[model samples]
Target: MKKRWIVLDGSNIMHWKGNGADLATVREVTRRLGEMGYVPCVVFDANAGYKLNNRYQDDAELAKRLGLPSARVLVVAKGTIADEIILSAARDQNARIVTNDRFRDWADQHPEVEEEGHLVRGGYRSGRLWLNLPDEAP
Candidate 1:
């Protein structure tokens, strides 16, 4: 697997600024990650559209917001948890997951959660997007 592959927790990142679900934050982050030479794979919960647009939106709609192809943007199936999907994608792709969540509950099953630089955490402190991606991996 290529080390440049990165998984983004779209469901969590959208709330980076605490202003509610904002796709702009996701878009900017995706753009920045791309600039840094990482291939972004964004995973969102099924209700992400409802939270952002007050209506149901498909993968294609959210993909447009992230400026990525529908294949790269995943809206998990209904009744499925997004965190699980995010972690699974990271594992499957041999990539790191970008999220503020510690995933303490899954630590027992996914020990990589405790590894350094495994769960890259970042958020906006003053309207500026920040990510803790390691220089080597990012």
Candidate 2:
């Protein structure tokens, strides 16, 4: 069996619903990743905790409810660039990125992204989330 490691761009998917990135979308993506036989590790930008706050909950409260394990989610430090972090992790682990972001700014840093299978891009469509992976063609 092949190992399928996926590095998810957490902030991007949280905002995929048009309102904001939320726990629901994150869970949905996680579930789908598992169903597809992929092991996922989600990465978030600094201050991602703050952005989760809505009318009913704060960061800590939401975190408790979210119950994500430490190993599964990673948050970059303040002032650090998330793209670099995401790219580095993917490269080291030989994983693909799961995000709609084109990462055009980091083309020089991650040249492999331009090649097929380096990035898994997708978005919401017709009330459902859709991800596009590279085709298995030589």
Candidate 3:
């Protein structure tokens, strides 16, 4: 069997508020995925009009520090939507997507792809990100 591929929506994970996620949280998630033997990729939006500094650079640096390949960090350029890029990547790579966005409805329309949504909360448990994996590829 082929290894499962996980594509993460970078913007959603970072929350895109200038500051990246807590290093521990990011490491924990990545470590968990690694232990599960999944190939992980993170995609972030990089439209020229986004008006955010260090968008791609920050993500790239983090990915590098985390030992992820540059190819795994997709920065969508201007005049396009990240969703389109994500969908295309999922279709082309036959990978599973992870995002908190409402793209579940759109993903459900596909018959050959898998998607997982993460619900995160910070509290006594130091926050948790729950992954909702689909019953089957769709």
Candidate 4:
């Protein structure tokens, strides 16, 4: 069977100005998912002059150094929206998406796309993040 794909909304998780806490959280989640053998794709939005002085360059570079597939970490150009791109990619690839946006409601409306909630518990002690998959009736 093909490995499950997890699409992450990089822009949503990073927040404006690239908050450190948010970035750390995202990195932790990504690392954990990799440990679990899940394919993760994180998409971030880039401005017109992003190539000149990009804030996420370090992130993209790190992902590259880690040998992450190019297709899995994308930086969408300006004028193109990240949310829409993420949704489209998920739908096209039949992959599960991870986002805190209500826009996920649209995916819930689709019969083919399964929507689930993620919970990350614990502060300093041993913690775990769980993916709450939709309950399936036998």
Q: How much is the lDDT of residue 126 in candidate 1?
A: 67
Off by over 4 Å in 1: 1-3, 136-138
Sort all candidates by TM-score, best to worst. 1, 2, 3, 4
How much lDDT does each candidate structure score?
0.88, 0.76, 0.56, 0.56
Task: Give the TM-scores of the predictions, in the order they appear.
Answer: 0.93, 0.83, 0.63, 0.63
Top candidate (lDDT):
1
Q: What is the C-alpha lDDT profile of model 3 across 1-138, one tens digit per residue?
A: 787777766656554232445434444555556676777776666642142343345456656755777767666765557877776777677776665565655556564444233322211122554444443222
> Residues 44-122, candidate 1, lDDT per residue (tens digit)?
9999999999998889989987789999999988999888888888998889888999999999888999999999998
How far in Å is the alpha carbon of 110 misplaced in model 4? 6.0
What's the distance in Å from true for residue 115, model 1? Answer: 0.3
> How much does candidate 3 score in TM-score?
0.63
lDDT value for candidate 1?
Answer: 0.88
Better of 1 and 2 by TM-score: 1
Say which prediction, candidate 1 or candidate 4, comes out ahead on lDDT: 1
Which ten-residue region of model 4 has the weakest summed lDDT? Answer: 117-126
Instruction: Give me the candidate number with maximum TM-score.
Output: 1
Candidate 3 regions exceeding 4 Å error are 16-27, 47-60, 104-126, 134-138
Ranking, lDDT, top scorer first:
1, 2, 4, 3
